[model samples]
Target: MNSRLPATPETLAEQAADWIVRLSADDPGERQQAEAGYRAWKQADPRHAAAAAHLESLLGRLDDIRSRGTQGPARQAIHSARPRRPPPRLATALALAAALLLPGWIALQSAPADILFADLQTGSGEWIARTLADGSQLSLNSNSAVDLEFDAKTRTVDLLRGEILVDVARDSSRPFVVSTAHGNIRALGTRFLVSRQDDATVLSMIESRVEVRIDGQEQAVVVEAGQSLRFGPGSENSLAAIDGEMLETAWQQHQLVVRDRPLAAVLDQLARHRPGLIRYDRSAIAKLHVSAVLPLNDTDRSLQLLANNFPELRIRTLTPYLVIVDHEKNR
Candidate 1:
């Protein structure tokens, strides 16, 4: 018996899988109805991103069930699961500046560092990318920041918060390195992504191999093309295999793909990409799972799109600092 959830597989696929389950109802007519409404809502405005994200999340989880043949396991069982908490104030700040303030970015720009080939950051509803001096690429996840120091000795970056994807151009002398709150990630002629989750560090290897040494104890994770792992501060790591096509790397092409992730996890991603925070009463909807591929540029439109698709969900704008998600919308 899978004790993690209360719903049966059929129940999950039918009525109770999520805040967007109605989009997959018994009647084909009803399914198309929901989808049509969702499409129109997505087209209505730019900020409808939160809505699209939620729907995408639902569809992604459904696909996972189709492929993996099970409902969502506990988030903790997965190697990439993270705790749900208030958006870091820093992330919220970044969210506001990166999207709406891009025209102002040139004002903040300084001479590019020699070793630090590129530096990119985004605010809510914003995304940014940069070409490294070495012909590599660095894509900054929403609400992410990096202070880079790179040279022949090593490629070093400080992840103040959020996540960064580093695509390394092969170089033997200039080894690529990333430092996060948890530990240091060193690449052996590799490409990888590093993220900060609270005090822990999540590492995903997209190519070759990388080594994570914590407190001088070297551990070779040797992530393959689609493997992911999370090493908490002073703890062992949980390994998970990933499909790169569904990751934020896809965001480079104006896409956001998700997998069998919890509602809280999806909400955090929204918070990172948009101004303000999209929070839920976790006590009210903790068991739901989400997956999606909404555009990364507009979160408000996404939220509107989500509300239209899941008529059962009630979204209340409490204030600029917070938005609440109700499991069912008021009729």
Candidate 2:
């Protein structure tokens, strides 16, 4: 059953599948370990490479079928099993994947400029609120970074990484603009939230309106109050109406509002405010829905809240920075 004894194509494919699932883990340490283990297993035998290649080809075929925009049993099953949420548009689906995908974290860690060029930055499990020279209030989430560039003509804020809530001051002469890897958000005397994801920028208009321009696009998309949009390379998704709860800006209040969301998604959001990593069972937790207000300032309490509500869920801490959550099995 072990990888060392693998000789058949079927066994190699199973091992490859395990590696693929592990590589999708949200924890950085787990992902690195999984990748290292995968490499070692692949090198153990030449046939392993061929079997892995075959599995990859099969996945590619599945992707191609998906790209054609055809609906089948696989698509229906995927959609039905997922938690209730907004429909994922092309690039939008992969944009926020940094929370669940290993490659996204890898890309973020490799970006030296995100730190080297940042004018203001906050470490993991830290929060900061500051007022700019123009009197605009800015609140950064954990592990967030931004660069301020204000001049006579324009007020530009380059979001290096993470999320920020901006309460913009009226400046007709100097338009307040926030830029990210995917696009630019120009506030028109308003308050808004901007979060930089793995492959896109998520903009939420809280007050008045903001014009969004995807990178390399001349035309801008206007998002009014109670609306949010996600745009990425070569694709701009449509706007979705925000709920009255205003979940996007809840971070400013040090609270995470969950309205019947999957446990897996909740853990993903919680990982943002905490240091190190949070590992959990995606399939098992996805079946369980959560609806509660968790405190952002104290992640441990937030976790306790989850455990309290879901008695079957077990939360374990191997270290101060590493946590594993899973469902309790019947003996």
Candidate 3:
């Protein structure tokens, strides 16, 4: 395949798809680096203008995918799979895009004033932990998200999505806190991994004690070492005591650890650590149970292992963005 960007509405989609595959390459430069290639192509031939224009149009829609309201799959799909190239008169297109998508592009001209407790993420096969100037440690578990907020009052972070293992730094004057969409966790000098589940946020405390407040509940539970708790969504409060570090917080090492969990949950966890989405018929394996410690960086190997154990499972990697398990291989 030439992997050239397409100009027409129908073929533009195909070009976008190709850009995603190349940008998602393990290399870090990605979009910025890919620009040089496209520019070179543009100089190579006049026809490249259409491809470049298509790509620029795609890039202009960047924030639509991240907007608070009215953002959905289409926006997310495009942003997550953003292409890298110099579209036709891209600078002008980008300016026009800013005007169209925002109240005023000038308002967002400057980066946000402050960034507190940032959770910098790396792609597949890259694992790195960072200790912020503030007394806190953030370990990004490949393809993770850590939302940060810091002010004179307190240093706080929200794991809006994905997984993070944190080692709490000591500072009595200010308590370190991490909150998710489902609940808020107040750490009292503790280390733990917090994962956002479909219906609850799972918190596994590795050291010291941590208090978790669910929704609007006044009563909070203290998770001790070797204990885990789940706070339900849209509910007052919920709690549980689970093994400390056994099958939990295991992604710290870039591995997916599952022990007899529902297959659906296990697959969801895998999808988070890797790039592509995993899809299976809800009816076929809804109740299936899974157990194993698999590597998060390699989707193909992970699927191969799954297919090996469950010969009845039919697994296919449709593209860089989608994986589909249609039916049992044996069937």
Number of clashes recorded per candidate: 34, 0, 4
- In model 3, pairs of residues that clash are 52-87, 52-88, 53-88, 226-244
Which 10 consecutive residues of model 3 have the lowest summed lDDT? 98-107
Highest lDDT: give the candidate number. 2
Candidate 1 deviation (Cα RMSD): 19.3
Question: Would you give me the overall lDDT of model 1?
Answer: 0.57
lDDT of 3 by residue, 43-149 (tens): 66554554444343434443342232343333333344447544433422333333223322332354233212244655544677878777578876655557677
Cα displacement (Å) at residue 231, model 1:
2.1
For all predictions, the C-alpha RMSD in Å is 19.3, 15.4, 12.4
lDDT string for model 2 (40-145, tens) is: 8788777676545544433433334333434322233334556654343312222212122332345466778757568999987888999999999999988889
Please provide, for model 1 over 1-331, each residue's C-alpha lDDT reduced to its tens digit, 9 standing for 90 to 100.
1224344322222221221333434455665675666556556633354544533442334444333433222211221232453233322233222222332243236423521343555665555678877777777867677877877687777777677788877778887778876777777566777778764787877777787765445555555667887787654686788865456456566555667666666667667776554656666666666666666666666566667756667776533444557785311
Name the lDDT of candidate 3: 0.60
* TM-score for candidate 2: 0.60
TM-score of each: 0.56, 0.60, 0.60
TM-score of 3: 0.60
The residue ranges of model 3 lying beyond 4 angstroms of the native Cα positions read 1-126, 234-249, 319-321, 329-331
